[model samples]
Target: MAGDTPRAQPPPPDPDPGGHHPHLLFWRWRRNPLRRRTDRLHAWIALGLLLAVPAVAAAAMLAVGDTAYRHYRSAAEHEARTRDHRAAVLVHDAPRHPEPGSDEAKKARYPVEVRFPGPGGETRTGKTDVEPGLPADSTVLVWVDSAGEITDPPLTAEQIRSRTMGWAILAFLGVAVMGLAAHGITGLVLQRRNLAGWEAAWAVTAPRWCRLP
Candidate 1:
């Protein structure tokens, strides 16, 4: 019974190429005595960039979109509030101009002379754009400032969202371009290191092979 001690287990087989060789995702990270220092370093950097590129791109998209939304919202809100909209009557028939790709396949815009009441109830006249085929005496909403100068309407919520998204898309593409460039540069460096390692090993072993014959 005293001699019944458990037998010492044989050391586990080396995970090297001799056995069931599993294809590793990052072979350089695996424990191998022959792996060169620079080779290992390059592998680590490659892995880092693979993980970091997408993360940075997503972050840039969010950051850029948020910044653009804030700026556009502020400017649009101020402009919308400062601008005035009034009901105006057409004084003369709208000018007809044919437009390409319009649903009607013709003029989409008509430059009409419009008349509207000022703050003091006096009639004011100006040239404004309207839908084609509108006759004189038709009513339309006119956008203007306090000084009676015509201006564009404020940005709607949908428009703000679209503008922000567009800018974010551009930023995402830019990030992707930069990431690809970094990846390409790193790959070239890794190739150079690999070739240098091969040359060094060959230099040491070539003389030994010559002595064998």
Candidate 2:
């Protein structure tokens, strides 16, 4: 009678005893206190985000550069408004006998120095011969100075124009690129373990026909 009674089939085994679900992976990675390939991928992404430091540095330089240019321009404008008179004097007179070991006497002789007054009783002196061998008239940038003092420095050279924005934009772009690259690298790293495990599991569970191909 026992043999005649049909034997109940054993319950089928689970498809994934290893628990290969995405949610499970996430939970295990978070709470199981074990580092996995997925975790390493995430760490790589974090490192990429850390690259933003270079971008921030670029941004700071942009800000400082703009501020410096503004100050220089202001100084130049003030100087022009107050200039009383400018003269072209050839540098000729050297003390009959240069003071021995005197710092003042050793000062460089500019064939011509442009002397100008500054705001708040300051005196500013700049070399007139900016381009050696060029005519004096071509080298001087004389502005109308009615206030009698140099209020500003010269406009920053044209080379510095738009550089601030360029740097800031470059920083933003760099951060973006770094972030994307890190994310991709992390994904690739994790995929190695995930794919290998998947293949092994498939081999054990699938029919013989699906084994290799």
| Candidate 1 least-lDDT 10 residues | 5-14
52 Cα displacement, candidate 2 (Å): 15
Name the runs in model 2 displaced over 4 angstroms.
Answer: 1-129, 132-161, 202-213
lDDT assessment of candidate 1: 0.76
Backbone collisions counted per model: 0, 16
Query: In terms of TM-score, how similar is model 1 to the real structure?
Result: 0.64
Q: Which stretches of candidate 1 lie over 4 Å from their true place?
A: 1-25, 30-39, 95-107, 115-127, 192-213
Cα lDDT of all candidates, in order?
Answer: 0.76, 0.49
Compared with the true structure, what per-residue lDDT tens digits does model 2 show for residues 13-106?
A: 2233355875654342354434454555565555556676566656666676677567656665665454544433323332222454566545
Task: In model 1, state the lDDT of residue 129.
Answer: 84
